[model samples]
Target: MIVADGLEKTFWHRPNAKGVLGSFRALFSGVGSAKKAVESVSFAIEEGEFVGYLGPNGAGKSTTIKMLVGILHPSAGSVEVAGMSPQLQRREVAKKIGVVFGQRTQLWWDLPVRDSFEILQAMYQVDEKQYALAMERYDDLLELGSFINTPVRKLSLGQRMRADLAAALLHDPAILFLDEPTIGLDVVAKERIRGFLKEINRVERKTILLTTHDMDDIAELCQRIIVINHGKLVMDGSLSALREQIGLPTTCTVQFASTPQIQQIRGIERIETNGMQVQVFYDKRTISTPVILDEISKWGDPLDITLAEPEIEELIRRIY
Candidate 1:
C-alpha cells in the first residue's frame, strides 16, 4: 500500500550573519550546509499491514512519513501510496490516507468534537450513510460519544487524541499514518488506544504505519518493523527476526535461601550473585527456560523466581 524507493530528503541550513546587510548577502549567496534527513531509504508496506517505522531522534522517520503523505516532497527517489505518486497526485493520495500527529490536531480548537467531525466529513466528501457508519463504529471503538460535544481545547490529552483518531478515520481512508499516537498518554489511555487500533486493523483491515518510541506499542501492534539510523535504513524485518539478529539473552533472577555455588552450564552465558539472589543469563534459542530452572534447583532451595524475556527496547538499542 506504501512504497518508498531510495527515498531521500535534504534540508539546507543557512548560516546566520551578524548584520542585516551580511544576512542579505548570505541569503543570496546560496551557500549553506546540507543535512540529509532521509537518504536512500527503501521499503514497501503491503495492504492491511501494520508496519512500525523506528529510529532514534533525528533518524529521518518523520521526514519519510511527510514524503509519503505529500506534506514534503522528496529531494530524490520516489514514493507511491496505493499505486499512485503522492507528490504528483496529492489530492487523490490524501483521499486514500488519514494522518494523526500526536502533538497536533486537525480539529478547530474552540469547536466541539462533533462539529470537527462534521467539518472533516464535508472536507472528505463522505456520503451521509458512510459518515453515520464511521461515527457509529468509531464511537464504539474510541468511546468518543462521552466527549463528542465537548470543545477540543477543553478535552484532556487522552480525550483529544481519541477524538483525533476518530476524526482521521471519519472518512474511512484505506491507509493510516500515526506519528507517536500514544505519546504522553497514561497506561490506561495508551492501552485503550492500542485496543481500538488493533480492532480496526483486524476487523476493517486498515493499513497502518506507526512511528512510536514506546517499545510496548511495537510489541503489541506492529507485525513488521523498519529501523533507520543516520538517515539510512538499518534493518527491516519481523520482530522475531530483530530479536534473533541482536541475540538478546533471557534473564532469570532467583532468590535463594542461601548463596549457592555458581557453576558453568551449557547454554548459560553467565551468572551473577548478590547475597542470597542469583541472576542467570542464557540464550533462549539454545535452551529452554524450564531446563534452566531445573538446573538452578540443584544448587539451592529457591525462595522466589522471575523470568523476563528480552525487551524490544534492548533489541532496538542493538540496531541503533
Candidate 2:
C-alpha cells in the first residue's frame, strides 16, 4: 500500500557568522553544508501489513515517514501511498491515512476528549451513523469512555494515548503511521496499546508503519522489519531472517545450586560461569532448546533458568 523509490531528503546546515553583518551576508552566501537524512532508500509495504521501521537516533526513520505522510517532500525519487502520490495528492492521501506522534497530541489541551472527537468528526466529514459506529468500536477497544469527558490536559499519558488512537481511527483510514506510539508509556499502558493495535490490524486490516526504538514493540506487533542506518537501508526482511543474517547466539542463563563441570557441546559457542550462575550461548538453528536443556542438566542440579532469543538491538548493532 506504500512504496518509496530511491527516496532521499537532505537538510542544509548554515552557521552564523561572527558579526551581525557577516551573519546576514552568510544567509545569502552559499556557505552551508548539506546533511543527507535519507539516501537512496527504497521499499514496498503491502496492504494489511504491519512493518517496523527501525534505526538509531538521526537514522532518517522519521524523515522517511514524513515523506510518505506528505509532511516533508523528498529531495529525490518518488513515493506513492495507496496508489496515489503523497506529494501531489496530499489532501486525498490524508483522507486515507492517520498519523500519531508519541510526543505530540492532535487533540486540544483544554477541551474534553469528546470535544476533540467531535471536531475531528466534522473535519473528516464523517456522517452521524459512521461517527457513532466508530466511537462505539473505539470505546470498546480503547475504553475511552473513562476519560471521554475529561480535559485532555488532565488525562494521564496512557489515557491520552488511548484517546489519540481512537481519534486517529475515527475516520476509518486505510493506513496508520505510528511513530513511537508506546514511548514513555508504562509497561501496562504499552501492552494495552499493543493489544489494541493487534486487533486493529487483524480485524480492521489497517496497514501500519511503525517507527520505534523498543524491540518488544517490533517483536510483538510487526510481521516484517525494515532496518536503516546512516540514512541507508541496511536490512529488510522478517525477524528470523535478520537473526540468521547476523548470526547472533541465543543465550540461556541457568542458576544451579553450585558450579558444575562444563563439557564440550557441539552447538555451544561459549559458556560463562559466576558462582552459582552459568550462561550458555549457542546457535539455536544448530541445536534445539530441549536438547540444550538436557545437555546442561547432565552438568548439575538447576535451580533456575531463563532463555532469551537474539535481541533486535544486538542485530542492529552488528549491522552498524
Q: Pick the candidate with the highest TM-score.
A: 1
Tens digits of per-residue lDDT for model 2, 181-207: 999999999999999999999999999
TM-score, predicted candidate 2 vs. hidden true structure: 0.91
lDDT of 2 at 3: 96
lDDT of candidate 1 over 1-320, digit per residue (tens): 99999999999999999899999999999999999999999999999999999999999988898999999999999999999999999999999999999989999999999999999999999999999999998898989889999999999999999999998898889999999999999999999999999998999899999999999999999999999999999999999888878889989999988878666788788998899899999998899998999899998889999998798988999889
**For every model in order, what is the number of clashing pairs?**
0, 0
Position 6, candidate 2: lDDT: 99
lDDT accuracy of residue 124 in candidate 2: 93
Candidate 2 ranges with C-alpha deviation above 4 Å: 18-20, 253-261, 274-278, 285-306
Each prediction's Cα lDDT score? 0.93, 0.94
